[model samples]
Target: MAFFLWLPALLLAALSEPAAASAGTSICNDTGALHQLAVTARTDGSWITQGWQALAPGDCTNPLPEGYQGRFFYFRAESPGYQFRDDSIRFCTKAGPFRAGGSGDCAARGYREQAFARARISTDSQKIPLSSRSQAAAAAPDTDAAGGTPYTAAVVLQGCSPEQEGAPAACRFVGGGMEIRATAGKQAAVPAFAFLMTLQQGAPLAVEGELISSFGSHGDLDLHSAALRQPNRHDRLLRQMQGRWVSAADPGDSFTLSGAVRQVSYRGSAMPPEFVSVLDTCHGAGTAGDFLLARDSERGTGLCYRIQSLGSDELTLIYLPRGTRLVYRRLPEG
Candidate 1:
């Protein structure tokens, strides 16, 4: 995971104002990991670098002394055993806590030229948020090497069975093998007769019976088994996800899915595509309407998209935080 500095710059005129005069830039550690911080800034035609400031998780420095009155400040941070880095802006730095004068000719001046990320001071003395690499990366967009949209469509689950006896209805194959009933609505308690079932389209009767016997036992059911079959479940999802999807309301927002790897390439009015991989998927422990966890393969960080409803052609996903529900339609194969 890489470290990120959220530096919102404060205008120079704002600095002279009463609010800015009393305010200074502060860095907050929003990640669970510890970090070592270094800062560089240009003041009065002289570049100065100071570093080796260690901060524990959730700790922050006091306003950094407002050492220089500059519009932009550069920062470098790293976790132990990882390489420390900044943004594209480069400056000279040392291995330990030390101050250096002049930013040019770093090698000749016995200093190392290192890249730094710019951090802007806010007028209201707001703290700059620093997140763990994984968190920052997850917020970034994904793109393919060819610079083309990877996926052509997206599908979300739709329609789930209603609850019964306060035990929550189990997902099952119904309607003369034409429809599937998936668990939906609020989460329900685990049933005493919990079972997992899978029904693939056009499967041989013998195979289907065997699956039913293996997965169907008690009266209750595990919804995960119906939507996510074992033995290459992730791979299966990856295959099903090979298409493009657009936000129903926001045409500018879209997602392109491609590759054997489970990843999502998002492009819209927000940011550039940086290709994010889907690391793994985890199921809940016998809970009805349990969240299906999808993680980043590289950083092991990801989001939990609630499986509201799932079927052969349509999928309904609900993000609880922002109350965002996305319904995706599968584009016909060409």
Candidate 2:
């Protein structure tokens, strides 16, 4: 869903620290000594948990937050503790060494509360409330009457006014957290794909709510990781692939090739005489559509092209390494 930013005309304020200084603790910061944790449950009733702390800001030696607060880390919780263990209590005091008692809610599971200059805190909504109409319909005796179990997520942005805009905007639990309609008898809780897409491209993000597990797609993770590494490569690919190329000549016109690798062509010819092989130049094999060709004088490869075209509509691209050029036009859309 798309939303335009429209706020009462007011002077934008600079991001400042909390009104009151915090002396509490934070487990969210990467380098803040407190370890952030992640637990993932698989489809086959299996799970994996990973924990690590992110790098801290300014002085790495600055005392870590003393209590449960702050946006210094990314926290993951599903069913509070049904599938994973809860250790918010130990985290508040110990800061480093922590242990999980058992599966429990965020508050009941032992998170500390204090008056320190904290960042953000998690909330519990007990249960998401359904509309009277929805509740009544759901009670109609037929299991399917209720909406089928799909990972449904309702994201609401409160304090949306500019006050908290750039302050690592928080995604704390709201209205009893999230409500999920599960398939009857399924042991797994559907994963909700939820994250705050910010105006800043690489600004850090944190989430402190429970969502269905389906939202954990490895494809998104891999793409995000790759983007962080070679950002320019992806940018170039996106730009070059979106070019609105105008065909130089109609395929119907009789054409003759005189370049290094010459081939004759008449109107509506499917194959081009010269093209640079994308595989040798870039990532994959170059094909007829949207290809750049190059020939080596000393090397005997007759014709080749960089495969700058891919997909049903050729949206992805394979470009020449550099200093290489291939000329060709796309087939006109019928």
Candidate 3:
């Protein structure tokens, strides 16, 4: 069994698991082992506990659609025959997936009280090295030549059951099937990439590996073969794309470049935030915009983007995988 290390970016993600999409939070289980997570949080002014995110090693889960940054979130992860129970902080959790809470007697409410770890998250760049013995991690490079198998339509996120088999591929068959290799030398895009079926229609979520999987599409895909797609320009975000951006395609589908945590927040879209784990400060950073659109400054993992053009008030992005162009107009920051 590999080690389970928590990325600081995911520490605050477990907070207040709201019933609606508002509970959007992304946490990674790069511990090199499978982990089942349970959380106790306060949502909509009420305390709630949600659980069983079955995160595989090197994979992450975004339970909600939108990202939230407020108070702390609590959770516990357990693998087969192994778990870390924080006997100090206790919460009620079931054996399977569930959401429950609001001050109650464990037994009376037909619930069992379990301990949870208080995950302290901050926008600052701080990494807690969780333990790991996976040789693949020790031998892989941070960034290398990627892309072996071409990715087409069809998306498959690590489902409820993530198989640990023949070197991770872009998308594996539901039960047991052939592994679709996407890219090669993609140290980061292996068994760790979580391909959730969250695309809206034929929306394209392009990564370095040409992973073109989306709704209504079916095929084996490979994510492990590619790294962040190299943007056309090595330049950074000019004028610093802050504030809200209204999609030219659909105004209802907008994303906000939060200056607070350097985080991206989305609305009315199945796709999660483009990037997270950026610096809280907008100014005084070297690698902030080096990747053209942006990359996770803290961990360099999450999905990145390629820039078409950035005017004083507009931004254009290209979904390289499908050759789809997206334009956005910047709205005044209030």
Most lDDT-accurate candidate: 1
- Give the C-alpha lDDT of model 3: 0.41
Assess the local accuracy of residue 234 in candidate 3 as a C-alpha lDDT between 0 and 100.
20
Candidate 2, poorest ten consecutive residues by summed lDDT: 217-226
> Which one wins by TM-score: 1 or 2?
1
Q: Give per-residue CA lDDT, model 1, range 1-334, as digits (tens).
A: 2211100011133344443243577777877766656677776687778764555667666434456567777787755333433467877764333467767887577556667778776666667667622143332332111122111111122223445778555443321101223343334423311332233332111102111111011111123222223334433554455566554554444455443222333342322222222223222223345343433222222334565655556656654333346665554555
lDDT to native, each model: 0.43, 0.24, 0.41
Which candidate leads the pack in TM-score? 1
Candidate 2 C-alpha error for residue 66, in Å: 69
At residue 173, give the lDDT of candidate 3: 22
Ranking by lDDT: 1, 3, 2
What's the ranking of the predictions by TM-score, best on top?
Answer: 1, 3, 2
Residue lDDT tens for model 2, 1-334: 0111111010022122133233332222222122122322121232212222222221121122234233332233211112222234222211111233223342454332211111233342121111211212222332211221222122122111121434322222111111111221221211212122232222112223222231111000101110112323323332333222222332342322221122334334423332111122322344334343332211112222345444333332223322233234443334
Model 3 TM-score on a 0 to 1 scale: 0.31
By lDDT, the better pick of 1 and 2 is 1
Q: Candidate 3, after superposition: displacement of residue 64 in Å?
A: 6.4
* CA shift of 297, model 1, Å: 34
